[model samples]
Target: MKCKTIVGLFLMSTLAVFSQNASVVSPNKKISVELRNSANTQVGGWYLKVNYSNDGKISEVFQQITLGLDRADQSFSTALKYLKTSKPNLINEHYSVVHGKRVQCTNSANEVVVSFENQGKSKLNLIIRAYNDGVAFRYEFPEKGGTFVVNDELTTYCVADSTKRWLEKFNPANEGLYTSSKDGNLQQDWGYPALFNTPDKGCWYLIHEADLDKNYCGTKLSNVAEKSKYKLTFPDQWNGRGQGEVKPTITLPWKSPWRVVIIGSLSDIVESTLVDDVSTPSIISKTDWIKPGIASWNYWSSNHGTKDFKKVCEFADLAASMGWPYTLLDWEWDTMGNGGKLEDALKYIHSLGLKPLMWYNSGGNHTWVSSTPKDRMLTHENRVEEFTKLKKLGVAGVKIDFFESEKQSMIQYYLDILEDAAKFDMMVYFHGCLVPRGWARTYPHLMTYEGVRGAEWYNNGPEFTTTAPEHNTILPFTRNVVGAMDYTPVTFTNSQFPHITSYGHELALSVVFESGIQHMADRPEGYQDLPDAAKTFLKEVPNAWDNTKLLDGYPGKDVIIARSKGNAWYIGGISAERFPKNKTLSFNFLPENVKYKLTLISDGEHDKKLVTEYMVVEKSSVVKVRLLGRGGFVACLKPIL
Candidate 1:
């Protein structure tokens, strides 16, 4: 009976191992997770291991094969065998150690370390943050980093297939993975899941997909000089992706351990978890140097000619008179197909008090400019030269248009432009681009990017009648969390336009949306004809703010945001579809014992006209308010002594 029981137990254990789809291979020693696609194909995998002291303290956690390699070579086959071997020597040279307590491992080439701490519940909190334009990850440690408590790593590994194609086609090199086939059987390269590694205490290593071309890759090390903070080092020969016509695959397989360190008690880990749920990336800088201002001509007005220069100047003069700092000399002014001269137009724009920003294409291809002069077009090598010319032309910034979509190569191309622009003190605003993922902080010169379905669409038709109202409310929670949005606000009034939401809602958007360089999206004639009180509010409204506070409302219903600059606060409130007749707003964050003079813009109580009312109020324990129907409100408050 005892012999039979032993045989039965062994059989049960084998089944248990097979059933575990994703789990820690060995608690406190190794951690791993496997992922399958919707088609049930094993597409990706992740693994982590830790070595620790006898007193329940971690010495190191080795990352063997966090993200599996593509089926490209014999080296990958050998790495798979090494993973199963679980032998100490099979582990790669990349391993991270924290003092003598804990260690981590990975094979990634680029790494960023933000902050880490310990939470008392036998868990250590590890935050693997990013300084570039990518996502971040967090890990939980058990018993002073003795055991790695992993949740799910599969979500982080899956790269959108479309993003890979975007990278290849838009990359300046023009090398990619996709091939045209009507039958849809094309040879495409799959993106590898990103990996992190720390061999010793020198620096953190990050390994990720270089671009759309999966053949070539590189790694970057962070925080090499210091033990506590981040310093970066790059490989001497490690040229990034798309460097060669026929991309060369790395000969060596990644077989290293990714590591993170914790200095304090377990309580630090618990505290870090509070922010773990706030998963979206945050902006590092607000693009203050770019100066939040207004632009004159937009996509619709780009066709206006030299004959209309006087009219354009009149608009620019009005924008400046209304306290706007900059105006745009959009397309057609370039003399691309026409005989217009850029140098001549720039001279006239500078004569006005407003700064001039011109439009350019990423690939130097515009609708009208069938054949661009070789010198004007942007190539990788000559990008610096073109930027220098624009700077010499006395342009404050350049609007790079028609990126089309979010592709890996296009994304990298944008980053390259931003890096170059910084060298010349030039600012960039991207059009037809993807949502921001905190790149503005790394490169402060990246003024703005257009990913939102903004005011420009209003010109296409009345499609906004179906979605615009809800889109405004949903974006703040989703896109705004990532970074600043260039949602061009304040379009012409509904009375004149007679399109989507009310004119009051448009006025409210000026306050609701956040942009370093905000656009007064309507024609100057739209607001110029309104009463002095309405015109004064638009003229005095500032685009940038020191701080922002969310007062009330949800995704699609309503939202109130208060922005502050010095002693003044600007409150903007918006409601979708219909305005609340008797909305009561609470001001709990206002300073106590201070009196404020408020300038309010709201819909008239009896008349249908939108009016600006002035009132005085004190910041007490709680302040109350009311709102009009389809009506929005904007109030400027000055603190009185």
Candidate 2:
């Protein structure tokens, strides 16, 4: 009788452990995922199997992700229960479209929300949001308010064999050269949102995060655990100043940021709203004062022969002459040699009809000590007073720089500044920071952020070679797809370094790259030498666009894009191949009923010249572009009256 009683209890426990598994598919039936448990095995946890349809054919199987985490040294992976009630059409039930900062935003997908709990002495609950575009899941602590330490995420993503990846060689800083590698041959820990191309299956995948607010530490993929699987890893310690292997300490009832996996073609990857869809909504209810536009920056040209208030004002005057909205005073303006008083510079810039933007160091000059309670200018005690003084002094915005760490405190600082700047009706730009994970939706006062290896590196002769044309071509695919990239385009003449690209290549970048403030990099003297038609094009280039279309893009090779603002259509093409590439461009993408005027900016007959040709063309017109030696081309089609 004792043996029978024990056997009955064991049988019931076994059934409960593995009984709560489920499978879900996208409404369009293109993407699907299945969740199951392996509590009986050595590596016990919940896992996922994903399948994506490619070219109307289902690709090879992608497998398993251990969907769990350890909190305060307790495991939350086994002996789980699935409370199966879910919201499958969360997108449709909510709104379908939203206004965006860079591109047209859409949320017309479906979702499957499943809840789970670990049945241990110290318990935890989780909610998983599976979407057609991607998957976004987070942990929800049940406590009303308390602290919990997250040990690590037990997530693993396995790719198809022989896949090529366009990921950065990882350093503590994301400022590394991106390279192409095979699944079996990775060079280093990759950057966030690693882009992988599966040519055999004709599909692509992007791994990244969203809604990283309220002090959450960012994550990257770990080194390979097998031939094709990579686990989640945390950022390394910098200066012994942050939560080193320990993830953020959560004040509870806390929900973690979304872990997203976007799967599709390169075009779908570029147009994915997975970032914005998962982000928090606007916190500032009255955001009518927020504005995004070009600003004149003197950093790229600060050390060119002279550095002073007079020279600084020259750039401001030029921007005002072009009718640009702002003039951003870049680094070291507070103490640069011969750069006169800050008040005088602001007074002079405002007199020229240019709104003046000043710069501040988040970490207080060159000290490695982190920017927080110690940074006097930005301290909790003094920040409001300083910003109020700037507001009264007629300063338009502030470009804060060097957020050198990705700790929870640094992330909180970003939100803190955004919130404060909004209160004063002032906008901001972030430098040396993480890429946008849809923070713009929450804080419209945040104009742009520089997380890319931008043109500013050209000031150092060796770095001119580093920021290659190929790097520019890859950005529109990997970095710019997620958010605004302050690449600071259009430097006509190279000063301290050798400019390897042709004139047309620089011209096309104005169209290819996306930014709220499209600061032109060259001095006014450079623009003084441009042809009349080229000057007109440069003026129109800074306007915000209503839409963007990626026509042709190959990783680290070439790309062609079409962007529209109002009635004008701007087409830009760039080639980074060793030899010249010639391609035919069709105007059929234009509206049929309207007549148009086309302005083509292409390579000139001589190596040192750029030629612009203007003409009227029909929708059927097809033009050829001969791109040579890291060269490029641009076309502006304006509707006829």
| TM values, all candidates | 0.60, 0.90
Cα-based lDDT at residue 562, candidate 2: 85
Quote the positional error of residue 239 for candidate 2 in Å.
Answer: 5.4
State the displacement of the C-alpha of residue 403, model 1, in Å, after optimal TM-score superposition.
1.2
Over 1-641, each residue of candidate 2 has an lDDT whose tens digit, in order, gives: 99999998998775554333355666566777766667543224677777788568875435777677777756777656555535455465332222232345555455555566566544455455556666666666665866777777777777766888888765543666677777656634677767887757477888787888865677777765665777776666652244343377777777777777787777777766677777786687876666667777777866631247777778887788667888877765665346566788888887787788777767543236443323534565566887898899998787777766666766777788888888888888887777887787777677778888888778756765545788988988888877777888878777667677777888888888887777888888777688877777887764466777777888789888888877888988887876777878887778887788989988775434788878887788888888877888888998999
Q: How many backbone clashes does candidate 1 have?
A: 49
lDDT of each: 0.45, 0.71
Top TM-score hit: 2
Model 1, residue 21: distance off in Å is 21
- Cα lDDT tens digits, model 1, 440-500, are 5445466666666676666655666556766676454433433456777776544212345
- Candidate 1 Cα deviation (angstroms), residue 549: 1.5
lDDT top scorer: 2
